[model samples]
Target: MLFTTPTFAEEKAAEKTEQYDPKGPILEHIADSHYWHMFGEHSLPLPVILYTNKGIEVFSSHVFEHGKEEYQGNYKYALIKDKIKPVTEAGEIDTTVRVWDFSITRNVASMWMGMAILLIIFLSVKGKYKTRAGKAPKGLQSFMEPLVLFVRDEVAIPNIGHKYKKYMPLLLTMFFFILISNLLGLIPFFPGGFNLTGNIAVTIVLATITLITVNFSGNKNYWKHIFLPHIPVWLYPIMIPVEIIGIISKPFALMIRLFANITAGHIIVLSLISLIFIFNSLWMSPVSVLFVVFMDTIELLVAFLQAFIFTMLTALFIGMAVEEHHAEAH
Candidate 1:
């Protein structure tokens, strides 16, 4: 055992001094960045978009050289912990100027790839449907039909009721988009590494859409329930504020739920993988690999479950907002 320990360790015992920094790399992998990492020092640098009072500037993120040095264009900017900020010639960050970044980051690229995959699959499926109308689906069509039907019939119809058709498109889009993004994030390679849905911004946007849909589709009865709440006149002062808060809270809940769940899964898997390096033991690899595979399989199930819950909850909220007075009479 002693003979093999020194040769097989990930890091020599003499060099292994730290307690293993899991948060640093794990957060990097799961967070948005201007480049897609391939291996050590090898990455695909994306374009950086910035708007400053001076003017708009566009450049390749490679100028930052993976955050080693500042990128000086017509303006000077430094990649400070994956964030680009204007810097002075002395290599100091210039706080005097305000800059807005709308860069196409790794997460954004992953989202685009996920969207492309969706288009390819659905477009092909649509073509197949036209060619094989009313017949049993085969191949990819066979694979997708049940999933589509589940979202349409199981999610949309039951929750949104008769008006479900109008919202079917939105719900279906949410389900497949979240599903595809979640699945793509698990790949840990090109076109799939970044956590798009796991990003709070993306989840916030989705939650906002659901919020807008519910409010816009709300009927007279729905508004009455919020403002007037079928409560005593004396309770109006207390209940009105709660109702208003409830509207914002629902969507907020959606945002946090999806973000936390997905982010936690990613962190857990990364933590397990980090164990091997932290211990510098090849013996740990088998155990680490087994746990990772097990966690990944569980994450796959979570990917589907989360998508379903988000769509289902959205439909339920929309239904409540647009429901007729008679159906809600009881």
Candidate 2:
């Protein structure tokens, strides 16, 4: 009985010790860790791993300091322990259970969101077509019909010509898919949080498609102009190479512009929120949250703006590539 008197207090102390106790400063919750510390010392080559239960982690190829020297290797499951860990000499631990090197990680939650968006748009259009076959559109159709017609009349037809109606499907699909994904990324909650368009790899892939389409769709005149534009004979030597370089540079510029702009927007918003943690004050958090939310609202418009800009530029490039110039006899 005397020994049992102290047992309850000891058990309570043990329970407290076993509970999760963070030993260091808490991290600011950024939208996605993909672009965090993008150019800083701890910048990662891959996106950081986020676990529902375990929190943030990284698979780093870090150098571990041995007693005398350092060695480099993959630290597959390095748990992000504390605010910062000393560059361990024994090599970082690989704690990553699954790797997501691709820009789009197909998690259960993301897949459902993607599927939901797809279904909603498809059903909306299907229902509209069912009710109004040839009659004037109403409701969802009213809003979407103009955008569809605009892309066809203003973008595809004008750029690609009468013989190129077949290509409209791909162009329209690309435009809408990008626009939808960009808009979905603006939502803060569970169903629409993924930054599909902001991923650099996705932008690169889109640019590659545009590059391929432009070159493949080019007529003999297009290639001739690239290799030997109608310049003075003496100037051909200098100008030919420049023209070729320009052709290559166009798509490269598109890739970089989209990637940089999207990534920068996300980073700015994240940095604004991180300001609270930097100051370590509850008072600072409210101001930081307000500013970040305002920027996020602006980003909603930017998402559509970027999609429109990309599509417009793509149409312009196609127009230039497919144009037929008539020259009078000189």
Best candidate, TM-score: 1
RMSD of 1: 4.5
* TM-score, cand. 2 vs. native: 0.65
After TM-score superposition, the amount by which residue 253's alpha carbon in candidate 1 deviates from its true location, in angstroms, is: 0.7
Clashing pairs in 2: 64-89, 65-89, 76-94, 77-93, 77-94, 77-95, 77-96, 78-93
In candidate 1, what are the lDDT values of residues 1-330, reduced to their tens digit? 011111123333433775665556677767788987764435788989899887778889888876777877657889887899889989888989799998998888878889999999999999999999999999999999999999988998888789999998899899999999999888866656677888999999999999999999999999998887766799999999999999999989999999998999988988898788777788998998899999999999999999999999999999989888775452
Q: Which residue pairs clash in candidate 1?
A: none
Model 1 misses residue 34 by how many Å?
Answer: 0.7
- Leading candidate by lDDT: 1
Runs of candidate 1 exceeding 4 Å displacement:
1-15, 327-330
